[model samples]
Target chain A: MKIGVIGGGQLGRMLALAGTPLGMDFAFLDPAPDACAAALGEHIRADYGDQDHLRQLADEVDLVTFEFESVPAETVAFLSRFVPVYPSAEALRIARDRWFEKSMFKDLGIPTPAFADIQSQADLDAAVAAIGLPAVLKTRTLGYDGKGQKVLRSAADAADAFAELGSVPCLLEGFVPFTGEVSLIAVRARDGETRFYPLVHNTHESGILRLSVASDAHPLQALAEDYAGRVLDQLQYVGVLAFEFFEVDGGLKANEIAPRVHNSGHWTIEGARCSQFENHLRAVAGLPLGATTRRGETAMLNFIGTVPPVEKVVALADCHLHHYGKAFKDGRKVGHATLLCADRATLDQRIADVQALIDA
Target chain B: MKIGVIGGGQLGRMLALAGTPLGMDFAFLDPAPDACAAALGEHIRADYGDQDHLRQLADEVDLVTFEFESVPAETVAFLSRFVPVYPSAEALRIARDRWFEKSMFKDLGIPTPAFADIQSQADLDAAVAAIGLPAVLKTRTLGYDGKGQKVLRSAADAADAFAELGSVPCLLEGFVPFTGEVSLIAVRARDGETRFYPLVHNTHESGILRLSVASDAHPLQALAEDYAGRVLDQLQYVGVLAFEFFEVDGGLKANEIAPRVHNSGHWTIEGARCSQFENHLRAVAGLPLGATTRRGETAMLNFIGTVPPVEKVVALADCHLHHYGKAFKDGRKVGHATLLCADRATLDQRIADVQALIDA
Candidate 1:
């Protein structure tokens, strides 16, 4: 089957790579002819919002999906007229805006931090007063990797935060003081069968994800799966979805939903029974969902900005390095290294081994 | 670095897939535009024997490799003037002809079956007298998967056997009373580092590979590694290589050397720390070799001729199905399914599960 991916990025490249072994073909749609997915399949150089090009892609592929949520809902709806879009246009519409996504989580009885929509400077002030100090002001749309968001640590910070965002529609979320952050990599089939990978503990540096360690020790592992299951059922979601959460006090609080394969789940490629990319293809292809069994204690380290020297990384016995073919720039996710081991202790050692190399 | 592959079959397709994550690009040189690897990367529609096309490809890519040994050695030697041909044109020259390969193995002090080159009917008669009944007659070149070889059960079968092969340049071999067949998948790097994956016990049906199970229990496992290491050192080979061997009485006899990834090693996709394809790419790209550590007890079942229903194989928790997207024909390797388990018992059960599926 031919699949049309609306964005040409590392995610699309990975999905294309995963699809090849299954005899599935991919066509990447992007304005950048040098997009990484171009290395894997046919890259159609056109704007994502170009209706003519989108329709042309729809005409060629059996189904359509996107690697990024920033794609305009109108463009997705337009393509849906020609072919089925997995995860639905509705999911994309909700996920595109922070306000709508958080509201949906609240309505579904899923746990999320207290949040209020801010439309203007006055609204932002009112929201800060209600949510209290140390809140986060974020643009309602197009925010990722901690961009387009500002933390209001003091009342003085809130006044400049609204001006900083240029009066865009936004959200003021009450910060949840948490023990640690975790995410659930879940896939919901078209048949409504939902599967969850083991909970992954994630660490961030300067608001960018640095490491992800798959663990069964999260106190809310069962609760996280339950929360993800309810969300999947509520949205009638069909495809790989990731739900980020914060461990606040003794419970889990929803952080956000990524309705696609995520970075934290990258370890699945080497440490699970089936990779998230492959399973995502299987689900999108209408194939039966495979089991989500972790192969071992797994940890993944992002090779941000610069890839570590190969000699250092290769010395680790069970580590698998994946370098996404992209020009290296500061803070860019150019690649990743996944370490699979028999136990957490060994995995931790491997993590230290890689960390030392990165430091060097 | 860019690499040019001469064939666009599964081997080439896999090489392209492995090369992409390493920031290496590939151009497949094939006459058929729709070859499988064509979808994976840049594909140049050119005949392998065309000197102009071969030179263009050599000038375009950093290195050149062939997915199959059937390519004429003269074509490879011509390309080598402009680009490095890995495994060397000499390796292909030796491996393509049965008599040359067997003679080289014997001269190198490697154990091979007792055999003699046969170019005429008189030579065949002499070979029968020396090797006796139950011997095999095979073409000197261009044969695989039980093709181009016939067994002589009695003296009466010899005269017609010569006619059956169209009386091409051939070899007659005395069949060894072997207990089992095993293979070693090894990679020799440009830096002269050689790594070997664990020996895999293989079973064939109707001359087609039916099953492969990795075993550390094979008595000749170390011997196989030592033998393969010597071959790699002697050839100064670079890239993934495989050696097929027969376990006879108490020792191993070398059968053949495939200077590329072998089908029996497909289990490495899920059963080893680094897959043979990835290792081959690393070797050719001059990157450090990856770990050859086996993940666990593993088995691979070839999906020849047809793909069994997914339900039949999906029950095994760790079973991975790889469908190569080729049009199926009688005795064709359309795809394979690999099952990774914690122990031998689990692997046996998984194999039984797949066997039941094929039986059904």
Candidate 2:
């Protein structure tokens, strides 16, 4: 099968890596002349909205999927006319914008933090009045990795928020004072069958994800999957979907959704029966869902900006390194490492060793 | 590091697949215009002995290795003048010729079948007299997967053997009345660190391998590893090596060695902590030897001449399909599937199901 990917980043690179062994061919579309994934398969160096290239890709491949959530929904809708697109243009439309995603969650009866749409300074004031202080003010669309969002801690913060955020359509969400953050990678086949990976605890540094550790028996797993199932059913999703949630006072509250392969599930490459990348391909290709059994305790460390010396990483026992072949720039995720551990103690020790190497 | 490969067959394809995640680049040289692995790396379509192409490959890559044992030792020797090649020309020379390989085994105090050199019909007769009847006559070099050998069961069969085999440097081996056949995959790093995968029980039909099952606690494992260690030490071998053995009344007798990845070790792709392909790359790249711990019971089924429907194979739990992307012929190995089972009962059931599909 020939698969057309809409973004040529590490996620697309990994998707190709997983799909090649299954006898699937890939072609990727990205704006970068040297998208890192170009090495793995055909790279069409064209803008996502470039009609000629989009038509060329759609004409060549059996189907289309995107790695980047920010890929404009209209682009997917346009290509869907020529080729089937997974997760659907509607899913992208909802997922790319915060206001729509939260509204969808509320309509589906999924638990989420109190939120209100903000269209003007008066609307912002009303939102602050209704959602209260210490809320998150975010642009309605195109925000990721903690970008395009600010915290309104008080009245003074809210007064300057609209000017700071450029008076754009936005959302005011009451912050969930949580004990931890968790995310679920859920896969749904075209036949409506769904499977969720074990919930993972995520840690962030300076608003960027730094680590994710899978907890198969986390107390909130059932609640997390329940919340994710509603979103999947409402979206009628047909591929991998990542739903982030906050563990507030031991209860789950929906944070957001990413309609594509995600970083939290990267550990599955070495720690599960089927990797998230492979599962996503399997789902999008109309194949049976693979087993999602976790192999053991696994922790994934995201390498932002630079890939550490290969020797330091591979030398560690039970650790698998994935270098995405991306050009290094500050705050860009260039690679990741997944460590397999037999128990919590070993997991802790190896995590510390890898952390030391990354720090050095 | 950039790697130069001498043959772009399935083994080379797998090596590239395994190495790419390590951030290594590959260039392959093969005579076939449609060498399928070419799609995965830099492909230089040329004969293995083409010095110009070999020079170009050596000049461009950090190290060179060959997947096919039939790659001429002289080619490796010539390239060594420009860049390092693993499993040195000396190793290739010994491994390619049955006579020299057997001699090396004997010199290293390793047990092998009783054998003698055959020069002519007269020499064939003499070999029968010396090694006794029911012997096998095989060419000294460039033989694989049931090719280039003839078995003699009686005195009358001996008269036509030389005529059948034609004028060639050959050997007459008194066949061991063995109970079973097994092989070991061993690795030696540049630093002389050596590790061996557990001995695997192999079953062959018409000299082409049909199945390989890892027998972790096989009684002769120690004996097999010990025999393999002798060969590695004597040759100072680097990279992965295959040592096939014949089980005779609960003991082991050496058969032959392949100085590259072996089909019998394909199960390691999913069943070992470190795959043989990864270990081969690590050894050739001058890295530490990876842990060779077998993950669980693994059985690999070779898909000779045809690949069944992907759905049919993958439906079985823990089965991994590796399609080689080769053009199929009557006896060509197009791909393989590895089955990971938890116990004897589950293994048998899964094996029966997969075998039924293969037989179908």
Candidate 3:
């Protein structure tokens, strides 16, 4: 089947990589003249909101899906008129904006950190007075990888925070002292069959995801799946969804949701029975979901800015390198490596070795 | 690294599928406009012997390799002068002809069926008289999937066999009353590092491979590896090679060697720690070879003529579908399904289910 992807980044590249073996073709829409994924499929070098390009892509492919949730909902709505779009415009509309996502979680009885919509300085001040200090002030939309957000650590810090955030519609969220951060990647088919990959423990450095380790049996597994299930069913979501959470004092709090294939689940490419990229394609293509069982002790390391030497990575045992074929730039995600080890000790050792290489 | 592959068939398609994840680009040389692998890489729509196209490919790629040994030795010899070519022209020359292959096996102390060269009707008669009735008369070059040859069960069957085979150079071989057929796929790096996949028990019908099951510990695995090692070393080969054998009287008689990745090794895509395609690329690209350990109870089912419905094949547990994206034709291999199960019984059950679907 011909699939139209709304973004031509690593995720779309990976989607094409996984789907190509299953006899699926892809067309990606991205403004970059050399979007990394353009190599894998037909690249429509156009903006997401380009009506002519959207129409052309819709006419060419059987369905449409985006690699990132930041795609404007109107773009998806426009494409939906010409071709089926997975995960729905409603899901993207809700997930792209922080307030809508947190409100939806609250509406669905999923516990979330206390949050309030901030339209002005008065609203921000009121939210801070009510929710107390040490809150995060974030733009309502267009934020990712910790961008467009600021920590209000003191009353003085909140003085110009609203104005500092471009005086835009925003969300003021009470910060949780979380012991750990985790994400659950779930895929719901068109027929409503849903499967959840094991909850992944994620670590971030400077607000960018650095590592993710798949859990075989995390204590919060059921809770994470339950939370993700609620979101999936609430939106009638079709295709992969990633929901992040903060582990609180023996409980979980919803952080956010991404309405697309995510980085944390990258380990599934080598560490699971079927990769998240393949499952996302299967789900979006109206095919049965593949098995989500974890294959071994697995962890994924993201290569920020620069990918380490290829020979060093491939020479390591049980390590699979996935280079995105993008030019190096500071803070850019150039590639990643998935290590599938036989045991936790081995995984730890390999992770350290890879970490050392990345650091070097 | 950029790779130039001659013969844009399913094998080239698979090689691209495996290599794409490793940040490699591909260009395929084939005369067919709709070559199955063309979708995966840049397709040079020209014959293998087209010098201008070969030179263009050699100029573009870091190294060159062919998916099939039938690529004329002269074509490889010509390309090698411009760019590095894996497996060398000498390797291709010996492998593309049955006479050279068998003679090499004999020289390497690898067991083989009694064989003799045939150039004319008199030569055919002498070979038949010496090798006895029930022997097979096969063209020495350009034969595959049970094509280009005929089995001579008696003197009557040998009447016009030479003329019938286009009077090409031929080999008459005494048929082996073997218990089964098996193939060992091995990869040799430029530095002489070699790794062998476990022996695969294969079954064929009408000379087309129907099924292959990976043996975790076949008794003759070492023997097969030893014979393949000799061939690899003899050729100073780089990249993947397959050595087919007849399991006769608890021993292996070399049937032939393919200088490229073989169909029998398809199971390694999902069943082995690293796929043969990826290892072949690693070898040709001068990168480190990946681990060759088996993942689980694995077997591959070839979809000859037509692929079973994708929905049905994928619905089965642990069944990974690999469609070649080729138009179906009688006796053509259009797709395959790899069944990876946790145990032998489960694999057997899954294989039967997939077989039933194919049979349907």
Candidate 4:
């Protein structure tokens, strides 16, 4: 089966890597000439919103899926007319905007921080008054990797926050004094069969994911699965979904949902019995979902900005390096390392060893 | 780094799949217009012995390697002038012909069935008289998958065997009344660091591999490693090598050596901490070899001739399908399935289930 991916980034590269062994081919549509995934498959170097390219991609592939949620909803809708797009246009529409995502979470009884749509300065002020200080003001759309968002700790910060964010449609969400952050990665097949990877403990630096360690028998696994199930069933989702949560008061609050395979689940490539990429392809291809069982004590460390030398990384025992074949740039995600160890002590040590390498 | 491969069959396809994640690129040189691995990287359609194409491949890649022993020695020698070729031309020379291979094994004190080179009809008669009945006559080169050979059960069988084998140089060998067949896959790095995966028990039908199950704590692992170590060190070999043996009287007799990745090691992709393909690329790329620790009870079943529907194979739990994307033909290896389980019972059951699917 040939899959049309809307974004030719590292996620798409990995999806191709996982799907290729299953006799699945890929064609990626990305505007960038040097899109990292172009080497793996056909690269349709056209904008996501280019209707001609979208039609061309839909014409060639059996089904279409997007690597990132930011793919314009109209693009999904346009392609959906020709081919089936997983995580549907409606899922993309709801996920691309924080307001709809949080509202859906709220409606489904999935806990979320106090949030209100803000369309004007007065709306921000009113939201701040109702939701209190120490809130976050975020653009309802086009926000990722901590961009297009601001933290409002006080009224002074909130004064220019609305204007600073280009005064666009926004959302004001009350801050959660969370003890930790976690994410649940789940896949639902077209037949409604769902499988969830264990919740992963995530550490964010500058609002970007830095590390994620797969949890084993976490106390909140059942609750996290229940919440993700509600969202999947509600959307009739058919692909991998990443649900981020802020752990507070021994519970999880929905942070956001990425309607595609996610970075937090990168460890699944080697750490799980079947990777999230393969599961996503399986679900999208109308095949049975694979086992999401964890293989070992696994942790994934993102290589932000630049990656360590390949030799140094491969020299480490039990370490798997995934370089995105992209040029190094400041604040860019060039690659990641996955560590699968027999015990937590070794995993922690390997993680620290890799962390030191990245820092150096 | 970019590497050039000589054959674009399933092995090359798998090598590309394994190396892509390491930020490595591939360009395959194969005459086949529809080589299965062509999708993974650049394909230079040319014969292996084509000087212009071989020079072109050598000029573009950091190093070169071949996936099969049948690659002509002159091709390896030609590529070696411009770029380093792993396993060396000499390794290929010795492995491509059965006489040289068995002679090397015998010289290393590695046990083998009695053998003699047959140059004429008298030579075959003399060898049959010396080696006794139930011997096999085989072409010295360009033979694979039970082709170019015939079994001699008696003098009448031996009378026409040499004439029937195209009057080419051949070898007559005493048949081993063995209980089982096994292969040891080992990798050697540039620094001479060597790692060996546990022995794999292989089953053959009509002289073609049908199944391979990785052995855990096999009684003869150390002995097999010792014998294979001799060959690796003797040749100063770099990259993955498979040494097949016939189990006899609770011991092993060297059968043949494939100076490249072997089919029996396919289970390492999921059953081992690091796979043979990755290790071979690492060794050739001057990187560190990965750990070869087996993950769980693992077995691989070859989908000979044709594969069952993808949905049927993937529907089984813990089954990883690797379809080669080749047109199915009788006696062809179209694909294979690797089953990983926590226990021997589960592995056995899954193996039977897959076997049933293939049969049905």
What is the C-alpha local distance difference test score of each model? 0.87, 0.89, 0.93, 0.94
Off by over 4 Å in 1: B310-316
TM-score of chain A of each: 0.98, 0.98, 0.99, 0.99
True contacts kept of each: 0.65, 0.53, 0.73, 0.85
Q: Sorted on DockQ, highest at the top, how do the candidates line up?
A: 4, 3, 2, 1
lDDT of 2 by residue, B171-267 (tens): 8999899999999999999999999999999999999999999886888988998999999988899999999999998888899999999999999
Which candidate order results from sorting by lDDT in descending order? 4, 3, 2, 1
| lDDT: the better of candidates 2 and 4 | 4
lDDT of 2 at A179: 90
Which ranges of candidate 2 are over 4 A from the true structure? none
Candidate 1 whole-model C-alpha lDDT, 0 to 1: 0.87
lDDT of 1 at B91: 78
Backbone clash pairs for candidate 4 read none
Task: Kindly list the interface RMSD, in angstroms, of each predicted candidate in the order they appear.
Answer: 2.2, 1.1, 1.0, 0.8
What TM-score against the true fold does each predicted structure earn?
A: 0.97, 0.97, 0.99, 0.99
Clashes counted in candidate 3 amount to 0
Error of 2 at A299 (Å): 1.6
Docking class of 3: medium
Compute DockQ for each candidate against the true complex.
0.63, 0.67, 0.78, 0.83
Candidate 4's error at A66, in angstroms? 0.6
Clashing residue pairs in candidate 2, if any? none
**Displacement of the residue B83 alpha carbon in candidate 2, Å:** 1.5
Model 1: per-residue Cα lDDT at residue A343: 86
What residue runs in model 3 are displaced by over 4 Å at the alpha carbon? Answer: none
Top of the candidates by lDDT: 4
